[model samples]
Target: MSKELLMKVLNHEDTNGQLPWIPFAGVHAGKLKGYTGKEILTDSAKLIECLREVYRLYQPDGMPIVFDLQIEAEILGCELLWADYNPPSVVSHLFDKEKGIPCKCKFPTAESGRIPIVLEAMRVMKEEVGDQTALYGLICGPLTLASHLRGSEFFKDVNKNPDYVVQLTSFCAEYAQKMADLYIEAGMDVIAVVDPLVSQISPKSFSKLLHEPFKAVFDYIRMKGVKSSFFVCGNASYQIKVMCETYPDSMAVDENVDMVAAKVITDQYNIALSGNIPLTTTMLFGTQQDNMKGVLDLIDSIDNKKNLIISPGCDMPYDVPPENTVACAMAVHRPDEVRSMIANYSSSGFDDIEITIPDYASRDKVYIELFTLDPEQCAACTYMVKSVTDIYDEIKDMADYVVYKYFIKEDIARTAKMGLKNLPTMCIDGESVYISIIPDSDELITEVTKRYNKKHDK
Candidate 1:
């Protein structure tokens, strides 16, 4: 019945019905059952056990089969750096922008790399929860998979050779289709193209480079009689309208976007929408009351609650308290009761914390600061950091360059101090040079060189 409610909401059929709650449990499912990220992701039995635990605890209306974006990348030959807590990060790429697609890289088969493990898990979960909860099969988005295959040079190709990017992304879309087909066969109710990288580019770039490829994947999913969702993780407010134009059944966003405003755009196309809960501030660090109040406030803020599904900004962190998630579920299930419980409740705000910022003009050395959500876990941040690092050897001595990762509590405060709004930003002397979008190597070098010359009067 809950799964039917969710599917009805996704299809925009039940306007007056209950709003679904999808936890995006991903690797966080493992944390619920005393399993590590590496353990549950690699083991089918463990993965199943963990997911069962999640269903028991959260009572989610929907849940993703697996949250790891690197499944396809790993199969296509990208090496990964596995972690105990979070999903694994891709550590190597198979293709280079200048060299073109690697001839040795072939399409992934159902027998290839971890697909067997995932398919096995999917088959079981469909049987276990298919009656009550909508199951999501998340495929790495076209641009993100292209970045995994082509490395940081993928962005360079976007500016210097768009035709190449189109070719690469088109190829990636085929892989996405294949992955989607596999999940559909394995009994996925919803096929989500998890392309966090799209949040980094402009709407124009998205249209020029990714429009058809994305549309193709979603269109194919539609033809298969399965619902589709386009999920992006960063501050993608700028691309919402264009994203809706691709015509996925739904669009899911992270904490960075304003749900009300995004919903206005999504509603224009009659696409159902999900998400915008703050992952760190509310889910991970805040109390149960905080979670409840956040959900209630979100529910209240949206004038049209018809097509909205409340979820964490992105993947749930590994350590989010089970009770906090329950609070969200409670608010969704029992809003009036929750409202009275939190009638006078207020969350402790971090706005009072002091943050020291860099003195760009007074410093003698050119300061190059890179802000990210940890380069290790986020692919967009990884490649954004890579764009600078790839050119570091060439500009190391030419300028006083330093890269700082603002992923921790203190650094998050510092990010606020620097007036940076987006993750994976490149700042030259405290000025935001690249926001979300990765810069070309030559552009980065030239900007750094100009800044260095101005600093030393060279």
Candidate 2:
């Protein structure tokens, strides 16, 4: 089938358009609006506002009403550690070794933690952009929700007390189905089950512990006559064939799996496949031209658009810029335009610039060195390098350390020799220390001081 026919099937519309476009703009939306993942998720009004901005900017064919996977877990008693730039991490699993497992896990009510926030956001999005965009309602899949509530124990439990694990997953499935029903009633076009943790489990355990529960969830959505999508993140290549066996109308995966292979499996099963983009490198950090080129490459590689959705591999980082996402959306809708833009673009003022740091070893003072890409070009890299510089300046004389910065573009051999993975890394005495994100000032000082003392003592 052509891309148009695939889109028609997705929207249940007349068969006359291209394949559906879905941008998994999770926490990235928060980043665009300068809000933390926790704040954006916990406040319905904020989430709606941010998404409204996204809708206005991207004009996507479909979008998830709430991109968070921890909502259901939060309601089930998991304590979340909220962050300013990223999604809140599940800090405390209620069923950990210290907490002990409960006899029964009950279904959560609508008023439970974060549930009401998500539902309200969905309602607002329905009222606002419901006519044009296919709003998706993302709920934690049974296995993932169980993992958040029980941590790694959920995996161990699958092997030890298989029956109890079945019961727990069954409860989670019902919870997910209930959440799906609520979102569907609120005007969501698709129900997406996000179970990233399942990538870690064996197919045997997944089949035994999760397969039935997943079937139950999908069956409930099928009964409602709504489309259901299964989303997984992480390296799940081994589970791809089995995931197709679950029979979701659509499946979305992250960059860890090969898209071509996933496409083959999904096509064989007649299930739609979406995504496989690198969220961290491509969406969060890459340039607009880079994003366009990457998307076009993927599009050219795929022979079948009959069941495909274009999207980022997983939840976006909170700091991902809005313009990059807009660039992606534009590329998806207008490949010709992207190509033209790339061709016509000229190097900006900061291009091809070389930066260097003066020798610090000859000086009598202790010295701190921060290596980064040009700050004027990369905001994230700039901030990270500045963070290290600021800490060194604050405690310079007292700690006997001088601070210096070196741009990566001018020092490729040095960067490569340090064996760094990402940009804006910190190095103390030629030893690469921190990666992309900046570390706390005091903590960095303490670490540097310890290293300095050890060197002097030796």
Candidate 3:
């Protein structure tokens, strides 16, 4: 709860103890105690009640006081569309030139917006939990705050108005300091700057527009003598190097980025690394055996430097059965028992790597399965599937290959079984051939024919 526990590990000091597990549950906890969305978020008493339940149920060593990223935006004049289960989404951007009312978009103060409500909640929670659990204050990152202020234009401004974007982000950095001050004052031990949008920009653009502003925030937090972490969701594979350079106490990545790659970068910086328990498949939908197997595999993959902390990739999804999280915790506390349960998992996701094809000495057909998030709804998925269909039709009669396309959301077990991570993946003969990129007609034909020709080998 203090610098001696999670903070010591994050600060890279000699803790000589186990690292903590902090799943970003936030509003998701409302599901456990049956509190409506507004009540859970707005009522301090309800917030306290939720905290007790979380500690009792999950026993997370560290937890966030509130994960509502919209507080700053709302204070700046943006409207929010609340959900019953999850935190509200920004319905209006306050600084977009065309859609935003620019005059209303200004920097917020401690007294502005829901800041008072949040500070009060933190104050109450801190008194309630005291030092028994580490408390985190998740301030919206500059890039993500810019997205709330300016909407999608924030992404474009990185290239279109890089200088202006930098200035605006600097303004966000100040707000981050204000929020951190309030949280620290309320007894928060960690200030996590959660900027889930940083991965959306090119690495070069991230350096130009985001790196400095983020450093300014981290530096300010360091001067305050509190622990800090940078949470970037999505495939931040491009921004990983630049992320470490910004000098956070720790860098928390998501499931989209492989822990192996994340470990290499975080180790170089000598910072603690946290994340990415499989949010949907392993934690929400999968069985205890599944969580144990996946969590153990993830735990074994990273270095035993005490830097790796296991947690869900992003905010824990609502409706995620408590049993799954308990299973995750079991993996932490009872590794031997959990490891033994691995043999019981039937729907082993990546065990498909051992997929063996029966001797195809005489078979004349190539079996292909196209995996997508949602081909009908996702534009890229739809296009990728179309490209495959177009080429397959051209050589369907000449080459005996059959394809079946499916949406990942429609089946988690199926998606996991294929060991597919990226969207718009095409698996031919038990191996992913094309991933995230649509293939050229010639290239597609060559690969398909190569497989089909092997079938007819005399």
Q: Which ten residues in a row have the lowest lDDT in candidate 3?
A: 401-410
Candidate 2 lDDT at 389 equals 50
RMSD to native, candidate 2: 9.0
Better of 2 and 3 by TM-score: 3
| Each prediction's TM-score versus the true structure | 0.96, 0.73, 0.77
Per-residue C-alpha lDDT of model 1 across residues 193-282, encoded as one tens digit per residue:
999999888899999879999999999999999999999977899999999989999999987788999999999999999997777778
lDDT of 3: 0.72
RMSD in angstroms between candidate 1 and the native structure over all alpha carbons = 1.8
TM-score of 1: 0.96
TM-score of 2: 0.73
lDDT of 3 at 430: 67
Would you list the C-alpha lDDT of every candidate in the order shown?
0.86, 0.69, 0.72
Better by lDDT, candidate 2 or 1 = 1
